[model samples]
Target: MKTQDQAAQGKVALVGAGPGDPELLTLKAVKAIFRADVLLVDDLVNPDILDHARFGARIIHVGKRGGCQSTPQEFIERLMIAEARAGHFVVRLKGGDPFIFGRGGEERAHLLDAGIEVDIINGISSGLAAPSSIGIPLTHRDWSQGAVFVTGHGKTADANPDWDALAKLGMTLVIYMGVARCREIQQALLAGGKPASTPVAVVHAATSGSQAQLITTLGDLPAALTESRLASPSIIVIGDVVRCASQDLFHRLTAEPDRIAG
Candidate 1:
């Protein structure tokens, strides 16, 4: 437990910057950023969002991007601890929702262990914003009963998500950081009994000005991705819900003729 004096002295806020769009930030998150004495930002966070920071607020970029050199996790934790100990309100601004694959849980645990006060502000996850940006609902009553948000990359090869089990769930699967391993993931899902014809949509930089997307089938995902050249920081949405994407986006891919009401 944090002592009253410790809590009053300093604190840290795990603020989600939302997807890529600066306007997507929640009101409370805006307030947190404006009041922050120091901000530790993630690589994926939109730079425009920083406009909300109060003038003269110290901003530190601690980017963590896959397949690229990133700030060490241990170092980031120590910095937050140090800043908070100095009686500064530290904001760990991250892209998307902090709790959803953002490593917020790990950070929270470390802060508590160090007796530092921590609070989390929710942001819209890219998984949700990405699909919605192009009019693809993750779940639909006539098609999907639920949605599953999963990471495409595992901490270790052996620790990867059970793609087979996930396929068997029959729920909408929204994969993050899976763009790099598209081929492997496609094979796993196919082997897990998912049909080759399953609709899939890969949205890159969802809700951002440079947003782009490709709609394809599970079997064609790898090839389509190669041909489309869409890269990481993308969301792969798999299921019939992908078929519900806006008509404009549907033109680029060969989709089944209107199966369900849009």
Candidate 2:
């Protein structure tokens, strides 16, 4: 029989908040949020989803926004360990699928090393959702044999993906957080033998009311992005499948001039 203190040792739940839509949150994620005594939320997570938390649940904003004053990963891990040891059911809420560039793995490792149990609740990733929202299929038998998802930014400069190799993969490429480096990416792909006429699309704030999209060709991508002023929190899709976007659906997706472009 364990003592009260021993039995009170709490566990951590790494919950994915999905892209920007509250409705995209998984039932497991919702249940985790409702049961959490404390939640460490990320910057990109939609605020509306927080409403799922039970009244009196302590919400902590530990979001790490790029190019901004962000929470240190070490600090976040420590906070989670501290909260859990204090007998609080801690929920580390992140935008998109927690394992998909959300750094959930690092947090899980830290907690496990500290002897804290961690549960992962998967959610929709923007890499998949964004393209679909704009009528672009990631993979199509006639257009692409496969697809690849790569991050635009890496922890170190040398860790950056080899654009040349990626271009040679002969598959659709879905880039996350690549808006800032769109010009460099375009140049790399162009130099890697990818045709200048390859179709491309940029989807911003996917699955949310503020969602927007831009359709262009590889040759025009850099200039199009510069002229359009699309920013971070966007996904870039490149491949022949972009050409497969239904004409009627494209028109409907772009109906709001302010929210879409070509």
**Candidate 1 Cα deviation (angstroms), residue 248:** 2.6
Full-model lDDT, candidate 1: 0.90
Q: What is candidate 2's lDDT per residue for 1-262, written digit by digit as tens?
A: 9788768999999999999999988898999999999999999999999999999999999977766789989999999999999999999999999899999888899999998989999989999999888678899999899999999888899988899999888899999989888889989999999998788889889998888778877888877787878787899999988876758544533453232363
Tell me each candidate's TM-score. Answer: 0.94, 0.93
Clash numbers, per candidate: 0, 0
Give me candidate 1's TM-score against the actual structure: 0.94
RMSD of 1: 3.3
Candidate 1 residue pairs that clash: none
Q: Any residue pairs clashing in model 2, and if so which?
A: none
After superposition, the stretches of candidate 2 with alpha carbons farther than 4 Å from their true spots are: 1-5, 246-262
Question: Each model's RMSD to truth, in Å?
Answer: 3.3, 3.1
